[model samples]
Target: MGIQVWFIVLGVGAMTLIVWDGKRRRLKQRALSAAGISHNAHAAGSAPIPDLPFEAMLPPEADTPTATLPVNIECISGGSRIGSATHILGKVIADEPVLIKGRLEGTLIAPNHPVSVTASGHVASYIEGSCVDIDGYMVGTLKANTKATLLSRARLQGVVEAPRLECKAGAWLQIDVAQAASRQSVAMVS
Candidate 1:
């Protein structure tokens, strides 16, 4: 009976030691993580992340595409001044506002400018800008400075990459909304 009791006590003590060791290891890991110390020094030097603007995080290269310039359409003949009958059918590049009262069917690029597609506009191309306001219909990708906004009547079909987004009622966005909204909110403030 004495030997059996001793063996049980030893077993319990071993379990306690194991539990204590596990706790100690976890604490050590926490301390290391808090200090920003990586387990392997070599891995940190291989991949260097860039601090890119909110819109240019993807497509890898930070430079704008030099192969083609964006098309710019100021107005369409016979189209309503407020955008009654216009159709944009090619790439657009500009440093000014593009008020559309017609249709756009190409890519729109504004590296350092903002683009606003009014409620009467219908866009079917990718949009890259410092700021994008969509109150119309967009069927392509949208990348804006920290945020992309969809007014009440705005409709989107393709991917949206913005650190922030604002989607009012009746706005139709197919991708993630929460993250986009957060990004946009941050962009607006900063």
Candidate 2:
């Protein structure tokens, strides 16, 4: 039988021929593990990252590092969120630490700070920050000024630009490394 015949016999959802044997059950687990979304855990509750104003997430410019404005930046805890069905639309900027466990669709700018996307978090936006840690489903651009780390259960898809990108053993990254060659000395231009 041809491929079309098999599809008709089974279903369109069964794209891969697993042979229904014990040898291929592990492949299904690998696919689930990479996305960072656990199929066995579900207890609805509050949101992960609260809905804040666009200006609230912005970092105050200062003459030197370790200095910030008098803006009251709230810190969110991971335990408070339980993968709630909340969706945010717009740009989110933060100067303090951020932990996302819900769905966000927009640009998230948190420079000079740490941004953590948990396994339950699903971000469909551009994320720019100092140190980015992903352990969930992310489908967008990730630009890290310092470093970007993908945990063992992270699943990212899109262009990722950074000086350093580290992926764990079980992390899944569908990306290609790109090096910047625009850093030239002043004397070279002269």
Candidate 3:
């Protein structure tokens, strides 16, 4: 065929491929919708969440002085948050701090930062960070370079490695604790 004819044929083929790809994406989206799965690009980190006032993210004030909040608002002010309604099953590597109030079933690596699991959070993954604070349930290994603090409502079942480990009075723990400078791991069942 002539050069001009070859160019025309190539142009037609490109258009056909573009159209086919669009249809394929639409079909995949439809299938996910039918399965009741969210296909939002924000969940995949392709887009940011819509901007909202900071007050909208804050928890309501307690009626009495004895009631404590589930999470520390100050710690989460500029950090990443996994809301209570979210369920994520992938790896997360954050340069900033991470606050989890939902469920996570993979790895979370936040070097030189903090990681917190709130009262309603549930995590089954490996966590590595500068510090870790837990008030929820976790069933995996946690490596904190500085400290690991378990609140009154925390429940952990795995291994914890930190330079300093603090457990509250009512925390439920069934795990092995390894101090950073120690050569032995302590088994604690409570």
Models 1 onward score TM values of 0.48, 0.52, 0.60
Q: Output the lDDT of residue 185, model 3.
A: 44
lDDT of 1 by residue, 95-145 (tens): 654456566655677756667777667765467777677877766567786
- Most TM-score-accurate candidate: 3
Better of 1 and 3 by lDDT: 3
Clashing pairs in 3: none
lDDT of 3: 0.71
lDDT tens digits, residue span 1-190, model 3: 8999999999999999999999997985676566444333122211222232212323344464433344452366678999999977667899999999998766789979999998888876477889899888876677799999888667776678788898775567666676645545455543
Show model 2 residue runs off by greater than 4 Å: 1-83, 182-190
lDDT per residue (tens digit) for residues 28-110 in model 2:
45654565533231112211222333233323343543322222212354322324477655567786767777876666788
Separately for all candidates shown, the number of backbone clashes (residues 3 or more apart, or on different chains) is 14, 2, 0
Identify the runs in model 3 with alpha carbons over 4 angstroms from their true place.
1-75, 181-185
Candidates 2 and 3 compared by TM-score, better number: 3
Q: Order of all candidates by TM-score, from best down to worst?
A: 3, 2, 1
